[model samples]
Target: MTSSIGVAVIGAGMAGKAHAAAFRAASTVYSPVLPEIRLVAIGDVYAPLGQEAAKRFGFERHESDWKAIAAADDIDVVSVVVANSLHREIVEGLLAAGKHVLCEKPLSDTIEDARAMADAAREAEARGTVARIGFSYLRAPGIAFMRQLIDDGRIGDVFHFSAHYWTDYGCRPDVPISWRYQGPAGSGALGDVGSHLSYIAEHLCGGVQEVSGGRFHTSITERPKPIGQVVGHSRGNVSTEMSPVTNDDYATFNAKFERCVGSIEVSRVAAGHPNSLSIEVFGSKGAARWSQTNPSQVEVMLHDELGDLAGYRTVPLGPAHPHYAGGWAMDAPGVGIGQNDLFVHQARAFLEEVAGLPEAESLPRCKSFDDGVHNMEFLAAVAESAAQGGATVQVPANAAGTTNTVGTNTQEVAR
Candidate 1:
């Protein structure tokens, strides 16, 4: 049923121009219409930033070689926004050239190259082809309506989770080094933004079965060698030639989640936090909070019988939440949403699962490459619990079940 597909994007930098403007705004967002996507090609080993992100994302062509969009047989979908040590050789050569990939999180830069790119995305998903892991902040509609109010119990048995993902773009030490200050010790800022706060604290509480105090520091221990490339979080011209950051401009940890208990924090030298991700959950009856510096509201508190008039209220997100109705264009409540509309709802749920659709017409699929090798084995058990000083490690069970999609279908909410 591939009537038309072809998309492409291999790092035109800055989240590769938000996955090339989210595949040119994924079939103009939502509804059962995908297939003719074809913006096709923007690859970049820097050919003028892949010809200025293929003339600013309309993408008809520009490929200074990501193996020419992985040996183009008309690229049937690809994203892999480069460098986490080139995500296991450009996502195992674009899933052995069968395409359908998303990639761009801490899925590599080691955990043995994210378990060999999740075993080449399970042999390119047994030939039907599909790989994922952009974790576009879980396509935020206030974190998908706070994971649908903690899977419909409205945050009732969670028992505590906290988070932080601060950023100031490496708070000035002349922000330069690049390859994000050269990886390896929980690959800086805890594998860059604590790998989205360890998959949004295990996508709202579940499977992080252990980790502990784990800390890492770095605080600009050396950075100043750009003079060229260095795109996203741009400082772009440095060369007093310093380079010796080797990882962690602050990271914190503590998790154990088969049923909740987490705390995670991250920083890129956070001084005034130019990009903050905050979360809070604590249930038995209620508590919720969200914050990508307020990406369309969620604050909640609910513990019935408000005697002295309760607390934490905010809610705002409209079209009955969870990806806001028709996925927004003024889909109601307060009319504002950002982070590039969560990469256009993660490129319309990876082009509705590469256009095979029917998972009740898709929106919640995109998280697996065995959940990016279980988020690089929970960031290698928080860099092996900060190299043994903070102790308590455990984390490696990964039977690949953090539930990206199973039941309670979503993606049809225009009411």
Candidate 2:
């Protein structure tokens, strides 16, 4: 027998809609032992945006006040997908209301806010409520398969990793200085896409222990005020006046992990690269590479293979890989897997745990609030290193003074 779980998404932006669609699709793809998700409310600062999103995403109600989602008795799970600065308060409110929360990443704008949210989430966990941070890229078929290979020792002791996440959205001079470019929102490319790269690196390799060297670049000094509202990656026209860009446009850093050395390069203004995240991991016995640009396949090389034929081979992802089986047949060639499909996979994991199904205990999890704080700590170290002219900086062992570890069990290097 299945039940119904009331769901509310507070935000009407690109990520918020993705969360909404995921709630609608998770049941169809995974069929977890949970109630059908009822998308009960859509909330945004703008009533029209909320109303339109509710109508488009099949939510039963819409409101400008995000507080309504927490106050509503019908909502059991809430997705807080607002800007980085909004996460702490919104997540705290929903958690206080006893609602299971799935918040967007980077946790909060500042370490203090992130620590508070992590503490609140810990309190919520003690009461058996779920608190998950969205790292939707983890659900990608290729990435998940890569994780399985690493766990199966196919890659053998990972020693080095290199990752790049680039987008061209900030390249244009006429681009408006929205919240993404403001000081209160945090670092530009480093906090925006760099957070995702840091999470992915830690997700694939292990917790980053220190940033040995870091550098930041700001290509455009200033941007015009937006003439109208702008969604992510969308160009906003200038209004003649310009404001100084307060964030880094690009960043490069070398990191030391528990058992591996890694490099992370992130840019929001790289030409011709849109939403591209390419990663390569080298191990003692083998290596693997994957890219979000071509996400359906993973390329791998093994030293034990025929010497003449020892080269990277592209493997089309299928249900044979972890998490893929939930979306399609064993032989299915990455069916039901798309950019949007990732959120569905993410939501299934969250909802299955919410249902208290035994299998959820063993599944890959949505990152916890504790992990978010750890990510912020790692980012802080990189920023500190960059700010001090590429000086190395040691990262804190724990972000919130808790024993919580960053990354997944398989990704954590044995200490």
Candidate 3:
């Protein structure tokens, strides 16, 4: 017999829609050893958005206020997909209410808030509740395959990692600005898209110890103010006056990890790339590369072969991969996986973890809020280095103002 878990989502935008879809998909596609998820409610500040999301996503109820869902006794799990500014309040509230949470990335607008969220997660763990950060990119099958290769010592003695996440959405001068453009700090392209790359790097490489150098550039210092609501990359009519784009349009940094030196770069103004996150790792024995633009394959180079024959080779996604079974068949042609599919795999992992089934123990970790805080520290260090004229900045061994932070130990993840 199957059990049912009550789930709620707090947001109605792109990420919220994805979470809702994933919850529904988790029940149908992946055979997670968890109670089936029943999407209970979807909440947004806008009643129409919340109501429409409820109808479209098959939620049993709609709420114009997120606080309602947080207090709902029926909700066993909640996905906090709201703005970064709201993460701390909502996540802490939900956790304090004893609800499991899957928070969207960039855990909070400030390191202080992120630290608090992590602490709350630890507290939740003490109570047998789970708190996960959404680093959905890690759910990609090709990336998972690459991680396995690295763990198996196929890429022995990892020494280098280079990555960049670039998008053209903010390239045009007329692009309107919003809360995403203004923040306490480190909230620009670096915190927005770069955070994903940073976490994935730490996930694949190791903990970042310091940032040797950093630089930032804001090409469009000012942007049109939107006349109305703005969604993911959506353009809106603007008022006559323009607002300053205080955040970095692009950023680059050199990082020292526990076992490797890595390069990090991110831009919202890149001309051609859209959601293009490219990462490569080099080791004493071999190297591997994966790009999000073409999410289905990984390129690898093995130096163990003769120098004349050694070169990068592409490996396409198939049934043998981590998540192929969830959406694609062994015979599916040409990478049929969709971006939304990653969230499904992510949701499945989160639910399985909540179930505590012996089988769930092997799944790739649903990154905890602790990991989110760790990555936020790295991002904070990079921003500080840039602010200090590109000088090296040591990443704090512990999150400041808080004694709580997750250890940098490598937790086992399902392949």
Maximum-lDDT candidate: 1
- What tens-digit string does per-residue lDDT give for candidate 1 at 1-415? 6799988888887888887887788777666478688887888887987898898778888988788788889888888887888778888988898888888887878777788788889989999998988678877778768777888897688888888888988889987887888877988888878888887787777777889889898877888888878788888679787978887888898888877787888888788988988898888888888898878888988888386978888988887777677875568898888898788778888788888877566777777877777787888888888899889989876667754443224545632
lDDT of 2 by residue, 57-157 (tens): 88998978878888998889999888888998899999998999999888889999999998999999998888988778877767767766777798899
Better of 1 and 3 by TM-score: 3
Error of 3 at 224 (Å): 1.6
What's the CA error at residue 264 for candidate 2, in Å? 0.8
Give the TM-score of each candidate.
0.34, 0.92, 0.90
lDDT of 3 by residue, 1-415 (tens): 2277899999988889999999988856544446767889998887888889999989999988777887887889999988899999999989999889999998899889998888888988999989988788877777777777777799899889999999988999888888778764468899999888887776676667789678888888898988888776777788878998888889999998766899989999998887888999999889999888778788999988787888998887776665565343332535566688889878877887787755434346577676788778888888898889889998765332221221211222222
* TM-score of model 1 (CA atoms): 0.34
Going through the candidates in the order shown, the clash numbers are 1, 1, 2
RMSD of 3: 3.7
For model 3, what is the C-alpha lDDT against the true structure? 0.80
